[model samples]
Target: MFNYLKELSFTRGAWLLLTTSCVALEATALYFQHGMGLNPCVMCIYERLALLAILVAGMIGFLAPRFILTRWIALLLGSYGAVKGLTLAIKHTDYQLNPAPWNQCSPFVEFPETLPLNVWFPSIFEASGNCGKIVWQFWGLSMPQWLIAIFAVYTVLFACLVLSQFKRSSGMRERNLFS
Candidate 1:
């Protein structure tokens, strides 16, 4: 199973699946924001950015999955994005579950000066909703809660891919040493 996973990581289909899944998630987020009339908060915006990172990683991997350099880059980016997104989602969930005057999220969204996402794309990146407000829920889970699960899955998959690479490399070294 581990060998299969290692081999799969070098295939285009795996990378395509990763890219397509991220695209679907992004589209769903936009739909929730516009079509469903759900406003995003600052935390949500940060999560979106993290998702974008994963998407870019997937694209890079898909471009050259067989290349070790590209695979490593993709793995690093995906791992970073997954961890960041998971952290943001947990914080967002905390804000919603334990609301207080001093423990609430800020009203304004602050992106880096070099990348003013809100200024460039107000409709998508602008954060006008309060983080403590539970505007939407499904199956008894809030948006942030759902996001936690999503990010967790992404993180686990990335970890597995990384492990597979290490295992494959070690196995190759062992074989070379014996020969």
Candidate 2:
């Protein structure tokens, strides 16, 4: 059992599985928010953006199966997510800081409001809610906290993948000489 767990942790398949799990978690959270009574706060939306980025990158990486590219993509995204998560957590530590003016969160993209063919949608750029409100939590850590952790892990995994690519390439060259 321990050996199996260790093997799973190091494989590309395991990373793919982890990506899928994260996607499912985000989906479930959204489902609960829209289907149930919970509404997303400002920070929640930011976190969603980070998660979406990761999900999209993961999907693309899965399609190509390039270790180096996948690792670089994960590293870039994980760093971005870490920054966002930290900002949100800091916001939550205080009060009376209006989340409106600081609102960097918005929908992925909404339909254009303009009726004419030439006119584009009037983007009502507005601020959103704060980071303090609890949408859901376990052991006192919010969803964003969990997301941060996941991203960090992904970053490391991708780095390993990058290393694995180099090792595999070198091994292939050696095998060619032997043959």
Candidate 3:
């Protein structure tokens, strides 16, 4: 199983699959925002950015999946995205479930000064909804709750890939020592 995972990390198809999944997720976010009139909050915008990071990482890995350096870079970026997304989802869920005047999310989206996403792409990055409002739910789970699950999956997959990479490297070292 470890050997299979190690080989999978070097395949372009695997990276493509990761990128495609993120694309589908982004499309769904757009559909929810425009088609369904579900305005996004600050936390939602941040979570979207995290997903975008993973998507970019997938693209990088797809470009040079066999290159060890490229794979490492992609792994770092994907891990960052997964962890950040998961954290944001949990906080957002908390905001919705335990609303308080002092514990409310900021009204404005605060992107980095160099990358003012809200200014560059208002339609996609702007935050117009209240974070504590439970405007949508499915089967007793709110939007943030659903996002927590999604990010958790991404995080776990990245963790497995990282471990596989380490296993492959150690195996290579052992083979070289014998050779």
User: Which is the leading candidate under lDDT?
Assistant: 3
- Give me the overall lDDT of model 3: 0.91
Error of 1 at 18 (Å): 0.6
Which residue runs does candidate 1 get wrong by more than 4 Å?
A: 169-179
RMSD of 3: 3.6
- Tens digits of per-residue lDDT, candidate 1, 7-94, equal 8888889999999999999999999999999999999999999999999999998987877788889999999999999999999999
Displacement of residue 30 (Cα, Å) in model 1 is 0.4
Ten contiguous residues with the weakest lDDT in model 3: 170-179
Q: What are the TM-scores, per candidate, against the unseen true structure?
A: 0.92, 0.55, 0.93
Candidate 3 wrongly placed segments (more than 4 Å): 169-179
State, as a TM-score between 0 and 1, how close model 3 is to the true structure.
0.93
lDDT of 2 by residue, 1-179 (tens): 33343333335686577568668967776685657646655455555656666676556545434344554565456445545555554554332233454544433333245633113411111213435455567798766666557656655555454444444242122212123
What lDDT is reached at residue 105 by model 3? 95
